[model samples]
Target chain A: MSIIIKSSDDILPSEITDQKVFEGRREFIKKIGFGSAALLTGGHISLSHAKTAAGKYSDLPKSAFSAADKLTDFSDVSGYNNFYEFGTSKYDPAQKAKSFNSDPWSVAIEGEVEKPGVFNLEDFIKPYALEERIYRFRCVEGWSMVIPWVGFPLADMIKQFKPTSKAKYVEFVTLYDTKRMPGQVLKVLPWPYTEGLRIDEAMNPLTLMAVGLYGNDLPNQNGAPIRLVVPWKYGFKSIKSIVKIRFTEHQPLSTWNKIGPKEYGFYSNVNPQVDHPRWSQKTERKIGEPFWAPKHDTQIFNGYAEQVAHLYAGMDLKKNF
Target chain B: MDTVINSNKYSSSLYNPALIKPAVFILCLLPLMNLVWNGFNQGLGVNPAETIIRTLGDWALYILLFTLAVTPLRKIAGLTALIRVRRMLGLIMFFYASLHLLAYVWFDQYFDWNEIVKDIIKRPFITLGFATFILLIPLVLTSTNKMMKRLKRRWKTLHQMIYPISLMAVVHYFWMTRADFRQPVIIAIILSGLLAYRLFVYFKKQQSI
Candidate 1:
């Protein structure tokens, strides 16, 4: 039920070891272990003191982006989830996602790739350097979460796939079925959620195909079994439960955009300027705090403009938004 | 309520309908537990406490609507077993709704009556929500078995207040989430249909004579 690949050529074993060894950051890592990743299921996610003490950020040494938002006002990472496939209730995925058989899950890299085939999750992603990117995820519902995600950037992965010149857009699709994903039964949303990225955006160093969050494999509520991680856009744009990754010249029709054309758009960037039909997007309240707690102002491009902003050069975000 | 509270009048016997009482009590505790867990884990994630309070408040209204439907369900299905469960469920509906109100009063306003009064007066959603919750007070006060016996012929007339309360709950839900009216609309339609069934049954009974 496992597929092993020997392509750790670009990434060194030292890097992996470094990520595992966070001795210098023991105190911070210890605090994070007990903090954002706290799930309510009586502790199904066990955090050994090892990962924290090993040499935490020494693993993700330098990147264009800043560290994970550690301000007290930053939202809780674990609970900001779009687990509709597991259930409509926010926490249902955390409870019911156990039934999902992800070890056997395989990711398909197709459509405009030179190496277009179905490779097992191990062979597809194991070779890449798993860097921890601290990302600010903004949901369309006007909530936000700052997650420390561990995965290779989407560009890095796409380069490995060797996408052809015809590939102008990248698309992601979740596993769609009634059995494992019981929430599909209720059809709270249109099934098999699909999202897309412009070619340059997908290839940006910041955009990621994350496997884990808070230094652990993603809990079901936060899109286990593989999902995209786009820090700048609203969380929905980073589609969850992905079973397919396709590269095409044509723009993909996003599920939410198709459902409600105005509310969700192709480039659903986190812009305080553009408000949702129902609620203001100016500010978001951090989780695990008081009801009347003051919200931190949401940053445009989720504060990644310095590194990733050029990708959207001359493109009117307001019109496209 | 204590004046009508029956002390050891009813026994744990075959005629008492044992399973129904426990189920109602269990259902009552579920929303409270849901609120507590959501609070502790910060499950709402965005404005955790506000979202938790709001979500629990919404659940209270829905449970209240569910409680109101029991009598109409009994009339429609022609089931006598459904009748015994109604009072217990009704009290729970009120209990959660009261907690929801208390959350708003204490946590949301810091027990500031001025703000609470202003919101109730100004916001249509809060107006209906608060009014519907207030309507539950009399119903809960009279929920005891002894009170049921004492009220006798008057019980049915008094309990009719649930119709307006359920209507206001639906309206409040609709007003809160303005975009997707589908959920609240479905609930409102069901509540209307359930009441219609009772009206139809009442007219049909007279027609049979």
Candidate 2:
């Protein structure tokens, strides 16, 4: 269940955008004085205004992997979140995480990695150029959204960390602070949410280490500073506000799986056939659609099966899920 | 019994069913009216279907609890006129419950009977909710004055099903909740209090006999 290495000729020309050219175009837009105005004109007027108010991540090149589907409204994406770190309700994160401080964040990289050290978020993300990858995000709760996530591939970051041969899996942990994240005061879930992926899955080109969304630095509710974005897996597998990364030899315990092993599986891939214990995953309500709109039939691996199916080939998805 | 009857007559005269019944009916209708206003105003949030279904279900449970509370409140507070509005409240609870089920069927399942049947059979929470809705049918049918007069003693025994129906609704809610049990737990506690009051009255009656 591994991908075959392809020669340079096998790659599509559209997939090979020159980073310098992209950055040059962005610089030209900024020089022309339309950069901020262009961002301010779209459906996300409030979001763009907020970004300008904060003045963060103004120049990001769009990625080749960006989805062609219509993007979910920025307000819906930001407002309706399942960040248990803030609270259990969907609206709680946006309301409660307004004052959360994500500044001076550092991620401690340890276990089976050659260059194991605590790297400041700025230093960690400085090496790679950020791009906007609009991805289809499917939640285990049977709702889906297409999000424009800004980050580089997790594979690029992994190569720099230099994980040893003993590293069979990569585990990520979210920041744990009772004062900043009031929801942590309750033991709703074990504090400091955790998620993991197989070494191959972590190195998948589709796996992103997101730092921003909608051309702005990540909002506090959407896991400010840094987060993982595994497009094929359920949204929870993409742990947010990560403060720790550990390359381990065994499969790590994820927060949701730990809470309800039978319901939330370790490999939470999007499969219509494998329904959640309490609800059917066969269909998903696209956020921001009219109430009368029919549900979209959920696709296998959220329509990323062509890219990720090889990783789980010959394995029982129903059992794993 | 004579004093209780005398108090009922006195309270009935004071409250005036003509005015109080209409007020209670309008009060019960306000939640539905608010939902309609929100629907027209784009106020149901991101997922309107989910919001409509959940809000309708919440109101149904609330009205169900309110209907159950009428007896205890009337007995304890000597507001016997409250009993006159109980039937209307019960019917309103049925209305919300029907809307909730319809939203799930039409918006969620898209009238796919196969999927709906499968959901009722496979999912325990759905089964409990569907069963609770079904149990309400007999009670609603026998609610009219003519049917009540004809059935008389049998009607009293049949209406007791509300107790179990309310309990099942709460259990359905508890099962569907993902993590936070605060909402369901609070409903369960209030339901327990209502049932406890009935039990206390039953034991007192038996002791007197």
Candidate 3:
């Protein structure tokens, strides 16, 4: 079962154009009506306007991996969503979240961390360099998407804050505003949604603190300001509009797991062998795929088991699930 | 009293079962036609399979409810001819329900018998919906005039299962939805209203007798 592993470092210098040139190359390719950059980098061409602007965020680092598949259409990524704070329907968030106020936001990082204080969104993101990583996002509800996210690794951010030795897990909390988020008035789920990850999982290189998608600031519906993006776990684990990050000694009760423990587990890794209580999780229908598109088989740890399997060395996934 | 009865008869006569029955039959096909048109035209949205499955399920439930309302409508409106369309409505309900089941089997389960069986046993919502579909089988089979004449009183008893089947449909819907029970809640309210009307009519008839 040993496979030749090729990290992005193994890529040839010619394969990766300078970030500025890459940005310009995208537009040049799009203007010519050919996916030339995709041909060179084996990167997916996002069908949505490609890039509305060629300006690259200087702070973010160049991505390590470019997916072989096409980036999900931007409309599908932004429009079809499950940010229940806006509403329960898939279309609800886009319509309702637009009015949500994310400006002048601050996030408080506390608990077992050495530096514990409220930092405004701008200052918090200023220090870390952002990277455009294309990752597979799998939802517990049997759907998936490949998104090119603009962010830095969660570990890189956590290291600067210096988590104490006692820190075993990290907890994330979302904003709790019912006035703007009409859906919060109804108790579809416990308000002010929360999610958590093991400290080791949090420190994983694949975990991203996303600030933007497709080289633009996140749309209101897509967890504006900042959100966690854990590629291996279920999409819910990647909490949105995060206001607080607390390093904890014990596992935090995630909102979904709190409401339906039997249905949603804390460690919701994408494993085809382990099915959800109500539905089979063996396959997922990619968003915006054709009606006749055959569902692709669910991959273990969403095809990141090579990097993340060691984190859960001896625990039974079925039991944890 | 004579004038009121005459007016009722005049209005009822306007319905003209021969014309109304065929018109209603065509009207009942509109949802299916729209669904098929949308399916062909790429109007079924991003998830066409899900849309088809859900739309068929919704129409089946609506048709079943409509079929259940026929007796109550006839009694309340004093339109005896309304009873003529009841059989047609029942067959239509069966048609949509069968399609719903087929869509789920073909698209969702991919004709995976083992998976389908597992779904029925493991998922309470599917179990209830499956039972509801099963109950329609006898009702649809004996919907013919000859079978109705052969069974006589027992046929009515057999068809009465529609009440419980309708209840199961609502409950199945309620359970399947993740949240926002508004749709199922509305369905529940409609079924309750229909049931209440039947009860009121039954009691009034009993008193009159």
Interface RMSD of each: 4.9, 1.0, 1.9
Ordered by TM-score, highest first, the candidates read 2, 3, 1
Residue A50: error of model 3 in Å? 5.2
Docking class of 2: medium
**By DockQ thresholds, what CAPRI class is model 1?**
incorrect
TM-score on B-chain, cand. 1: 0.82
Q: Give a tens-digit lDDT track for model 2, residues B1-209.
A: 54455555556565654456787888888988998999999888888888889999999999999999999888888777788899999999999999999999988888889999999999999999999999999999999999999998999999999998999999999999988888999999999999999889899999999
TM-score of chain A of each: 0.80, 0.86, 0.86
Clashing residue pair totals per candidate (backbone < 3 A): 8, 0, 2
Tell me the spans in candidate 2 whose CA falls farther than 4 Å from its real position: A1-39, A42-58, B1-18
Model 2, span A1-321: residue lDDT tens: 232223445444433445554455456655655455545454553233223222355556667665656668778889999998899989999999999989899999999999999989899899997877878899998899988788999999999999999999999999999999999998889888999999999999899999988778898899888999998789999999999999999999999999999999999998888989788998998987777878888877877765777888778777877
lDDT of 1 by residue, A171-268 (tens): 89888978888878876677788899998999887788888765567766677757898888998888887889999989999988888887788999
All-Cα superposition RMSD per candidate: 10.1, 4.9, 5.3
Better of 2 and 3 by TM-score: 2
Q: Judged by DockQ relative to the true structure, which candidate is superior, 1 or 3? A: 3
Question: Which residue pairs in candidate 2 have backbone atoms (N, alpha carbon, C) closer than 3 angstroms, thus clashing?
Answer: none
Model 3, residue B90: distance off in Å is: 1.9
Please state the error at residue A115 of candidate 2 in Å.
1.6
lDDT accuracy of residue A223 in candidate 1:
78
Between prediction 2 and prediction 3, the one with superior DockQ is 2
